[model samples]
Target: MSNNFKGGRGRRKERGPRTNDQIRIPECRLMSDEEQYGVVSIDKAREIAEELGVDLIEIAPTAKPPVVKLMDYGKFKYEQQKKAAEAKKKQAKVQLKEIQLRPNIEAHDLETKLKKAYKFLENGDKVKFVMQFRGREMAYKDMGKEKFESILAGVCEEASAAIESPIKMMGNRIITIVAPVKKK
Candidate 1:
C-alpha cells in the first residue's frame, strides 16, 4: 500500500486526466421549439438546467435523437472519481516470495519454513516452495514429494491451489508455486 492519496506540496506531476476510461452516464436531450418533435423545447430544457445551476451538457450529437443532461459536470466528474478510487482500494498487488527447503530438513526447520510461508501468504503475496535434492537424494524423491504434500496441506486455506503441481528433477530441485487467497 502506497501513500497515493497523500496530496500535499512538492508532489510529482500526473499524466493528465484519464477520460479514456470514463463511464458515460445517462443524460437528458434537448431540441428547439420547431424541431422538438415529442421532446421538450430547447428553451424549456435550458431553463431547467439553469434553475438547477448545472451545465446543459450535450451527451449525444450524431444520434437520430440527441441526448443532453441538466447535471453539474463537476459533480458528475467527482462521483466518477470516487467510484474509481473505491475500485482501486479493493485491488491487491500480489508479490512473489520464495522459500527454500531440503528433503532432509528437521522438524524445527520445517516448522520455520511453514511459518514463513504463512506470513507470505497472509501478506497478499505468491509463494514459491523449493525443495533441493542432492546427488543420492534424487533416489529418495518420495520424501521430497511427501514434504511438498504436507506443506501444501498446512497452507491450503491461506493459499489457493496453483494450476500446476510441483516439478521434480534428477539431482536438482522440486518447485511449486502458490498464490495467496483474497483477504476477506
Candidate 2:
C-alpha cells in the first residue's frame, strides 16, 4: 500500500484567523494594547510586531483597510478557547426524557412514573409521556386519555411543571410534553 491514500483522513490544517505573513493586504489599520497605530504599511506593521515580539493578526479583514492587531497569537487562541469552554459550561442543556405508560397501569405504578418525571423536570429536562396501547387496548383510548390528563394535572400542580404540548393521539399512543416552570 502507498503512504498517501486517496481521500484519506489526513492531518487537517488550522483554519484560524490570518496572522503574520499570512496577511496579504498592502496596508492595514494597526492597533496594539498600548496604543493605536492608525493606518500603516504591512511592512511597517510586521516590523513593529517583530520589535514587540508578537504576531501581526488580521482581526477584521472586511473592514476598510482591514484592521490588524499586534498580539501573542498563541495566547489569544488559548484565551478564545478558554472563553468558549466557560460558555459551554454555563449553558443549560435541556434533554428530552420519555416515560412510557399503559392504560391499565395501577395507581401506585403511575405515581412512581410521575415521581421519575418530576425528577427529570426539576433537573432542567423536558418530559414526554407516552401512553402506549397494544392489541385490544386500543379500544380504551378514551380511558388512557383521561388517565394521562389526570397525570398531567397532578404533575403541573405538585411539580411546578407547565404543559409544553397539549395531549394528542398518535397511532397507538397518547402523547404530551411537560417542562419545568422557570423560576424568577
Candidate 3:
C-alpha cells in the first residue's frame, strides 16, 4: 500500500494576508488606527497585538522590513468580501444579440427585425446584424452592404444607438454591430 498524499493534514491553502504566527519575517513596521510603531521585531509586534486584543496581520510583505497591522482579522476579511460583492453588483453586463437578415428580405420583415434590434439596444445590449447570402445571392453583396448601411443609420437615429463596427463582408455574410449610447 502507498500513501499518495504529499502534504500534512490536507489543510486548505490560505489566501489574502498572513496573520499572527504565519508571518515569518524577523521584523516589520507595525501600525494601528491610533499610532505607528515604526520598525520592530516580529515578536514585539505580536506582543503588542496581543495586548490590544487584535491579530498581527502582515499586509505588505514585500516592503523593506515588511508591514503589519493590528486589527480584527475576521472583520477585515468581512469588509473585503463586502466591497467585492458591492463592486460586482454595480457592474454592467452587456449581452450580444444577433439578428439575421437576407439580401432580398421583404420590407415588412426587415422592419420587424429592426424593431427587435431597437428593443435589444434599449435594454443595454449589443446588436449584430448578420445578412446572409446563399448561392446566387452572393452576386448581390453590394445590395446587402447598402441595406446594412441604411439599417445602421435608421437604428442610430431612432434608437439612440451608435455603430460599434462598420459594415463588413465576411465570406457569404455582411456583418455590422451597433451598441446603445450611454446615458449621461
Candidate 4:
C-alpha cells in the first residue's frame, strides 16, 4: 500500500475567501443586505464598497461570475467566530467515569466509592461501575451483580440518574453505565 493511503501528513491548509483588492476577477455577482447589483465590474463593485465604507468579499468563488458580498469584513469575521464559539459551547460532552471494585468489597469502602459515583452523577457525567473477579471469585458472579445493583440504586437515590447501559459480564469483569437524567 502507498504511504499516502495511511493518513498522509502533507495536506495544505485551506485558504479563506478573497476580499477587497485580492479579488482579481473582472466581474462578479454583487449582493448586499439592502440590495443586490447583479453582475458588475470589479471596479464598479470596489467603487460601491468604497462609498459604503465596507469591503468587497468574494463569498462563492466557485459560482459563475463568483458571487461577491459588500459588507464590513471585520464585523463579518467576528460574527462568524462568535457563532462558532457559541456552537462549541452548546455542544454536549457525555464523559464516562469508571469506578472499579472487587466482589468482596467492604461496607466502608463501598460507601466511599458510592460517594464518588454520586458526585460524578451530580456533575452531569456518566458513571461506569465495574466489578472485577479473579479465578475463584468468578464463581460468585451473583454477589457482584447484587452489590453493583445496590450501589447503583443508592447513588441514584438522591440525584436523578438513569441507567444508560445494562449490567453485562465481560470475561472476568462486569460493567454498567449510569447517566444523569436530563431536565426539561
**TM-scores for the candidates:** 0.58, 0.89, 0.86, 0.77
| Candidate 1 lDDT over residue span 40-154, tens digit each | 5556666665665666555564554456555566776787789999999998787879999888889998888888888887776788888888888888889788877777766
Relative to the true structure, how large is the alpha-carbon lDDT of every model?
Answer: 0.66, 0.92, 0.91, 0.88
For model 2, how does the per-residue alpha-carbon lDDT over 14-100 read when each residue is reduced to its tens digit? 588899998999999999989999999999999999998999988899999999999999998998899999999999999999999
Off by over 4 Å in 3: 1-14
Stretches > 4 Å off in candidate 1:
1-53, 58-66, 134-136, 157-171, 179-184
Model 4 residue 179 lDDT score: 91
Candidate 4 lDDT, tens digit per residue, 35-88? Answer: 989999999999999999999988999999899999999888888899999999
On lDDT, the leading prediction is: 2
Candidate 2: residue 62 Cα off by (Å): 1.1
Query: Can you tell me which runs of candidate 4 are displaced by over 4 Å?
Result: 1-13, 21-29, 33-35, 38-43, 60-67
Better of 3 and 4 by TM-score: 3
| Backbone collision tally, model 2 | 0
**Prediction RMSDs, each to the true structure:** 10.2, 2.9, 2.8, 4.9
